[model samples]
Target: MALHLYALAILMGAIMSIYIPMISQSARVMGAAVMGNVPFFFVAFVTSVVIALVSGQRGDSFRKIADVPPWLFLAGVMSAGIILGATFLVPRIGTGALFVLLVTGQILAGLAINQFGLLGVPAQPMTLSIAAGAVLVIAGAALVTFGAVT
Candidate 1:
């Protein structure tokens, strides 16, 4: 199960690497970042409905949806913001810089989430090694984002 999870993570990474560029290009072609999200979410909503129906857990999923707090729905808002921001920034920053910066921000947020057990995540107290690793990641992001152009 753990190996499968790792593989899924890698797969997600690959998909996202392509997904951002596609979003970027679509936004450029459409001449509006916000416009890109219309079809994007339309497909996302349809795909989610299909998955729910096919998974045989639609009832359970709907039941659990009611259990979630209203504030948690802000995640959808945040998702829209993230997608919009990515669409706008990718063309300006280029994919490499955008990805590195995004990963850097995610790592920092992950650290906080782990430390505090935020959003029901398991608490994992920060250690020196973890902090050092975060530092190294930030440095790498800096190099990738601001390094001299060839």
Candidate 2:
């Protein structure tokens, strides 16, 4: 089941990778980027509220969120920062390069999360494949940056 789930995730990611820039940059053009992800998370949260209002999805599924201390609101602020960074980055670097950096960050972050097992996330046992993939992503980002410069 895990293998199949991973496969599906990879497939969907591959599909999205082809189109994410178009969507993000379009939003950026409309000044969504400058809003610091107010639109991004607002759209997501509003959709969830709409879905709940329509489908009557009950609470307790997000019981864990309520468990969080109030001070953690900073995460929401940081998410906006990240969204602005990505939104602006899309126009400056193009999607391919922007995503390469995103991938690089994700890889490093995943490693850190695995190392510390933070946020109730299970620690993943890393193999050589993970390291190789990180190295490849870094190389890819470097290539894109160099190509764009030259």
Candidate 3:
């Protein structure tokens, strides 16, 4: 439980830090996209490798990748697309608005994923409360995006 809380705190800090440098992140992601994902992925892969090596928990996960479903591998592609898209959108929409829309999309996608029990997760039935929460999120996104307009 303590480790979970620590991880959650770190995640929250990371999220906050990302918004502070969103423009730089966007530019870097765009540059990476243009230059080819190999360099970008290589850097991130090496960083992960170093971290794993230092942590002393370097399991044989890579060796077992072939055993996992092929669709699981698409996460890398999806991550690249998301990074590129966020890079393009953040400048146009502003970080706060972009984050609102992104969070809304994430919640909706999560709801669907949970509903269908995708990726080997247990099925989590979506109740009316969940639907209502999703609706509220969309409404909040709209307000964040358009509220300033006359």
Candidate 4:
């Protein structure tokens, strides 16, 4: 079970590596598409609105303020944090470093997940080995990014 949990965490790290670069590439393409320095961020906002409107519909849907769930409002607030973080961080560090930071952040988040035993995920007690491993992994990332012997 411990090995399985570790594998999932590594897989998530790999996924973050791939997905973040892909998104940056897509954003660059979108930037190239507009030619007028049009903010690529509008793409996300536009899609978000369309998704909420379309997916919110049920077989016999009725859109009403009173029917709106508080959870949806909370989600919107969270989304704001996500978008703001992306805009600020992505431009500064570039996607590679940003995803590296994200993976490290995920290590902290995963520990919290383990501590609380959230979402039926198995709890793995944190240890020095895990902390040392995280430091080593982050160091390896730095070496790969900045090049060794530089």
In the range 1-150, model 1's lDDT, one tens digit per residue, is 589999999899888889877877877788889988778888899999899888886677778888989998998999899899989888788888988898899999999999999988999999999999999999999999989667
* Top model number, lDDT: 1
In model 2, pairs of residues that clash are none
Please give the CA lDDT of all the candidate structures.
Answer: 0.89, 0.74, 0.74, 0.63
> Candidate 2's error at 136, in angstroms?
2.3
lDDT of model 3 at position 9: 77
Candidate 4 C-alpha lDDT tens digits along 56-136: 755345346458867667766665455446545676676666766666676778878887787579988778898788788
Enumerate clash totals for all models, in the order shown. 0, 0, 0, 0
Residues 1-150 of candidate 3 have per-residue lDDT tens digits of 599999997799577548434544646666743344345567889999888778875468656667988878899888777666666665567777877877788888899899999878889999999999989999999999889989
State the lDDT at 119 in candidate 3: 72
Q: lDDT, candidate 2, residue 79?
A: 67
User: Which consecutive 10 residues in model 2 have the weakest lDDT in total?
Assistant: 31-40
**How should the candidates be ordered by TM-score, best one leading?**
1, 3, 2, 4
Better of 1 and 2 by TM-score: 1
Worst 10 residues of 4 by lDDT: 32-41
In candidate 1, which residue ranges exceed 4 Å CA deviation?
A: none
Higher-lDDT candidate of 2 and 4: 2
Model 4: residues >4 Å from true position, as ranges? 1-76, 141-150
- Worst ten in a row by lDDT for model 1: 54-63
